[model samples]
Target chain A: MDLSAINPTLLLASLMVAATPLLLAAIGELVVERAGVLNLGVEGMMITGAICGFAIAVNTGSPILGLVAAALGGAVLSLLFAALTQYALANQVASGLALTLFGLGLSALIGQGYQGIKPPSFPKADIPLLSDIPFLGGVLFRHDFVVYLAIALTAVVWWVLKYSRIGLVLRAVGENHDAAHALGYKVVRIRVAAICFGGACAGLGGAYISLIRVPQWTEGMTAGIGWIALALVVFASWKPWRAMLGAYLFGGITVLQLNLQAAGVAIPVEYLAMSPYLITIIVLVIMSADKSRAPAALGRSFHASQ
Target chain B: MKLSKLLATAAVALGMATGAMAEDKTKVGFVFVGPIGDGGWTYEHNKGRLAVEQEFGDKVETVFVESVPEGPDAERVMTQMALEGADLIFTTSFGYMDPTINVAAKFPNVKFEHATGYKRADNVSTYSARFYEGRAIQGHIAGKMTKSNIVGYIGSYPIPEVIRGINSAFSHARKANPDVQFKIVWAYTWFDPAKEAEAAKVLIEQGADIILQHTDSTAPQAAAQEAGNVYTFGQASDMAEYGPKPRISSIIDDWAPYYIARTRAVMDGTWTSTDTWDGIGPGMVGIGEISSEVPADVKAEALALKDAIAKGEYHPFTGPLNKQDGSAWLAAGETADDGTLLGMNFYVEGIEGTIPQ
Candidate 1:
């Protein structure tokens, strides 16, 4: 095995690209869960966004418009979930699961004639002087807009949850919806807005995949990344920045495993293939420890009377 | 009492008449491992299904379940089809081998045909295309075209079918260019576009100018196109859209003829448990149009090689090859038998890395 064939710079560069979608999706879910709502429909929302963005991009010849449509599509789908869990007092778990199934079917329907078609190219952002820096530039400065956006979004999420009043209210609702309601906050309205934001973020993440990563549309293209993002959210202790770390670690391992296989490393292929999930779980589980926990009111329905 | 008895007799007669009508139309069910629009493996299989419908018209009724997982779910689908009175079922995936057999045993009246598999029952038949023949030609082109001397192969699994293609491609590539090295990466999936694209990009980054894939997606072709100067081959289906550059040619699986013939066999009551492994000779495997990007001489040679294989003048696995361990596998000028090729487990000499166990 020629280990030298695996370039660390390229590996880290691609890892950023690979982790962007997961980071986007997880960050959105973090906000939703922080608002005391658990949406298990990340996969569905991601796939729905994938096709929506792909279709619009293919037609409009603008990836930016496609990204917008994807976010809107995801938010529209989440509205259904909000209506079910928030207004109708449906079970959060069942509604989220149903949302995923509905999204899969809906995307497949919308994606009928869109298969095998490539979306318009999204150019890389080679930061002026920063991109020219030796090794770090190659690894960190050379990526498309979505990668930076995902990281920025993570930071924004962290700041909001840490210091912003809106973040405080969202967390309050998540921690104790009844108490937040008593504090003169429109609990349902807050949760609905948070859910929509999560949906939009998930949509952007899905579009990042279709518009940049794979750059094509295929059924079930998102695969199980949605589920992995969900797991990452819990493992990162619902911390936005840790979710970013967890995403890169997972993405790094995934790309690294493929690199190892390509370089014909002596390790068994199966173990290397599964290392992304295994290692991410181990590291995140260790990082989380007993210091963090799920929001107390998560997955619970809150009505004014109840 | 007499009027009630008369009404019951009439009801029984109507049920018998409808049953007879239902029996007249042969119901054929298909279970696919990926979506029909995958633009690759399942796409070809679905075309065959459509051909079956076109050939029989009103004489046949076809039902298909796309992207069915190959496990208990496959068995459930087959059983459901049988219960729905399907006379024949085609499970188009190697993973469905055992499920097809088990399902066939339950519904003795239903004829089952499993693709790219070895298992068979009294009512189940196994059929697969000899895709390695096309791989040999691709290897030659890749060998002649690559400047980097590093050929990357994206494998779907460690199955014998994939291993055979890798070995065949590598050997012919070596023959054409002695310095050529095969760098293989197993994606372990049949149709994950994102993962397949990632695998392709990784290979390109590692200096492999030529990318070969066993997975069922056009994502690799897109990746190769985006990389500029990197070449890839269309797999299972004719991905002509990416052609004239990255996709110089393709190995197209034409199952329409076989599917129609098998359906006709069931119609004729001649369907029996059989193993059909056909290559270019019978047109089961077709080498797609070699684009103008391939040089005239290389294209001519690739065509000549295809013709030779089709005419049975050449066997891809013939002669003087050694196992990866340097142990001799085939004697000089000796051709590989079907039994060994069907169960191929080890890599041939000069191809680095062990097949994932």
Candidate 2:
């Protein structure tokens, strides 16, 4: 094994890109859960976004427009969930599962002609001076614009959830929907908005994977990353910063394990292959040691005068 | 919900589906684990299916379902095909081993051919190409082309098939350049593009100048292109689209000849269960074009190795090789037996890391 082969700067730098998708999805989910709605369709929304973003990027020759289209696509799909759960009063869990299935099938159908077609490359934003600094420059400044946006979104989510008046109302709505409704809050409207935001964020995550990560269009390209985002929300105990921490932790382990293998570390292949998931499980068990602290009405559908 | 009622309903559904499709032709079916547009392993298999259609224009009817998962879902798809009067079926992918046997048991009158699987029954015949033959040529090129003497290998899994390819490539690479080193990264997935690309990036970061992948994705080729100066070979299909650079050569799997012959055997009522393992000599494994980007000397050497292998004048795993712990595995001039190679689980000499239990 080549111990000297592992470069800390490259490791930390790549992990930032690796963590962006999960962080985007988790931060959005944190907001949705805080506003008293539980959506299990994150996987579906992500895959749909993957195709929508891919199609737009390939057609328009603009990754920026593609990313915007991805968010809109995700929001549109989430509105369908909103219609089913809010208007039809269907079981939120069942509707969410259906959404995921529908999204996977829908994305595959949309991605039929786009398979194997590469999207135009999005250039990295290597900030001047800062990016030239030895180790920290590579770690912090030499990344695509999305990396900075992911971190900024995390900080904004954490701050708004903990400090703002809107944050207080969201937390109140999650704590007890009946009381929030009696307190003159339009619980359904706020929950729908939160769900749409969550969908858009999840879409952005899926789009990041298709447009930048793999940078190609293929059926089921998102794989099971949406499920991981869902698991991260629970692992974070409904906190935004903790979700970022979880994303980076998993991302760091993934990049580190790959480096270890490339360095010819003598660890058995099976263990190294599973190291990322194993570490995540250990951290998740520790987090679950405390009381869940989930939103009181997290997965409950709100109905007035029930 | 009674068994009899279920059977009756299934029979009626099957009759409705096939009655409209049945014609005076041999019914052939294929099951693929990936989309036909995968541009790699499944793409080659689908090409074989297309060849079958071409071989028997008006006398054969071809049908296939893509992206069949390698478990119970595969069993269901196969059983459905049998019920729909598919007289012959080909299930591709190693994970379909047991499922093929299971589906064959109930469809004894119908013939089944499974690729890269070992198990066989009365109605099931197992067939796989000797892919290591191609890996040997790839190794020679990798060895000669490396400026850094380090070749990164992206392994899909630790199964015998993948492990065998690693040993074959490493042995030949080391033969050409004694100082050469191979670093293996097992992605444990067959078709996840993002994961495969990340693996390639990690290997590139670690000083790998020539990347070889057993995983079925164009991601590594893309990663190698972006990194520039890195060389790669396509795994299963000729990914010539990368052209002239990263993908300098490839191992093209040609299943058409065997598929057509097997279908002919079925049409003639001579089909039976058997194990078929053919290589470059028998035209199952094809060496793709050695791009001009590769140095002339390296390309000629690689082609020489390919010709020797195809003519059966040489074996990729020849003698004087030791196990990972330096134990004597093969004496000088002693060729490995088919049994040992089929179940190969250990690394050859000078290779690092375990096969992963």
Interface RMSD of each: 1.1, 1.8
Candidate 2 residue lDDT tens string, A187-253: 8888888999999999999999888877777677676788889899987899887788889988888
Which one wins on lDDT? 1
Residues B1-357, candidate 1, lDDT per residue (tens digit)? 999999999999998986787778999999999878789999999999999999999899899998788789999988999998999899999999999989888899899999999998899999999999999999999999999999999999899999999999999999999999999999988988889999999999999999999999888998898889899999999888888779999999999999899999999999888999999999999999999988999999999999999999999999899999999999999999999999999999999988999
List, in order, the clash count of every candidate structure.
Answer: 0, 0
Docking class of 1: medium
Model 2 alpha-carbon miss at residue A196, Å:
2.2
Report the lDDT of model 1 for residue B85: 90
Predictions: Cα RMSD each: 4.4, 4.0
Task: Spell out the clash pairs found in candidate 1.
Answer: none
Writing each residue's lDDT as its tens digit, candidate 2 over B1-357 gives 699999999999998776765766899999998767677888899899999999998788889997787789999999999998899999998888899889889988999999988788888999999999999999888998998998999998788899899999999999999999999998988787778888998998999999999877787887888788999998799988777787899999999999999999998999989999999999899888999888888888888888899899999999999998999999998989998998999999998876778
**Location of the lowest summed lDDT over 10 successive residues in candidate 1 chain B:** B15-24
Give stretches of model 1 more than 4 Å off: B1-23
Chain A TM-score compared with the true chain A, each model in order: 0.98, 0.96
A267 Cα displacement, candidate 1 (Å): 0.5
